[model samples]
Target: MLEKLLPIQKNLNEQPQNPDSSPEESNTSPNLLESFKDDFFESYSFVNKATLILKLFILILPGVFFFMLALNDALDRKIMALEDDKNVLTDELFVYPDVQAIHTSVVLREQILKQVNEKEHYAPAMLDSIIKSLPEGVSIKNEMVQGKTASLILLSPGPLNVASFITNVLKDDFAQEVSILSANLVMTQNIYEIELVVRYR
Candidate 1:
């Protein structure tokens, strides 16, 4: 066996050692540029992804703060405007011309008071005297007595008798004076109606 292996060993020793064939020698040599290309690409891809993330974070920061400030300012302005509008409306409510509830109440009270006062304006004794003095065939249409004078309208049959009666009444001591204010002659069914005004005590 030893004698048979000697020839193979001698042949192995005769083979030449190529310097570029070793793995360590190939790594140390800088001429093989394709070997490191995958590592460079992986490192560049990682760095690009990181840079993109950082830029996105920086861009979003100011936008978030600016939005918050804008919302706050809008709310402040809205609140101030509402307050001013409320104040203006409150002030205007007082001076508005159509708000007449108080004035209407006062006017109603005045009208009622005036009606009540007018009902009680006459003296009782004077009213009694005028009612007692109404004569037959000489009906008074209206009478307004004040102080010592009594003004009245007398209805008579004719103008001649009314004139004579007026003259006679004026001569009496109780009569003060006589002056006719209005006269109207109405004729119907053979009857003459005369309206005359007379002044008396």
Candidate 2:
């Protein structure tokens, strides 16, 4: 046993005193750390590239979508405004006929009033002339005065009386032109009907 122990002791004395200190572990540690650093840098670079792309996508995509959405909203609002204007125009068009009618009636009324005012001054003299020239047997049935023209419907007992009435009207100084529109014998009333149109100077 003592002889076996002596060899073992000799082998033990040839070895290093510190069991934890190893040259191989010291040499391999730096290489492993370097490899780990290289791997970390590669991964970090890839991650940074991915992050940049993601950030760009995040920034631009939402902005593009928002712009498109805003444009659509603006177009929609414009269409609605146009529709509202069209409806208003349509409503006005619907009411236009009544407005036009009222305007036309007012114009016609004004024209009638203007004509009446213009002829008022000559009405008394024309009536006086007509009355004085009328024959004794001729009776006026209807008389219409318009502008410078007068229409008279006379009822006479005979053709001679009607002829005499027309002759008397033609001799009047106030008349510029006189025309016998119609002369008809009314068998029912046994009278001659004379229609005359006269124009004043």
Candidate 3:
């Protein structure tokens, strides 16, 4: 309620001032240094977990790597041993003198069969047909079978007998082809000698 009067005060302009900093910034200076120290020195929780994971990987990696290598080496040796045993067994089988020859013969037979594609086996029916077709005066002298073909030497009283036999043989279903290889007259025996080939279907 008194009348306004001028108050005595110090001259603040005479003192040096920091134009860049406020009172609020001056109060936070010490706290900034403390925060910097914490950031530099402290470990974060995520960083600790990552470091643990890295350590586990380092400890386990070499053991797993070496174990895999050893397992592979053992498998290789086992395979080699099996191969050696197989070779030895194969060789031992051939110790019987005829085994190798038999094997070779079988292999050759298979190759021949595959190439020839011959499917028929001469049965009793074939023998019956041949015997039935032969005339009474005609006789089969020598007979040999090779694959799908048969060769025979015959003694016939006359050429007519041979022709009749050939005609009868060709009438049978079991014969696919027929050929006469030779014909000769035997003066001493008074018989005609004939060679014949028959191919079966």
Q: In candidate 3, residue 54 scores what lDDT?
A: 91
Candidate 3 to truth, TM: 0.46
List the candidates ranked by TM-score, beginning with the highest: 3, 2, 1
- Scored by CA lDDT, what does every candidate get? 0.64, 0.81, 0.81
Candidate 2 residue 58 C-alpha distance from true site, Å: 76
Q: If scored against the real structure, what TM-score would every candidate get? A: 0.29, 0.40, 0.46
Instruction: State each model's C-alpha RMSD to the native.
Output: 17.2, 16.4, 10.9
**Model 1 regions lying over 4 Å from their true place:** 1-42, 96-201
At residue 17, give the lDDT of candidate 2. 62
Better of 2 and 3 by TM-score: 3
lDDT of 1: 0.64
Candidate 2 C-alpha RMSD relative to the actual structure? 16.4
Model 2: colliding residue pairs: none
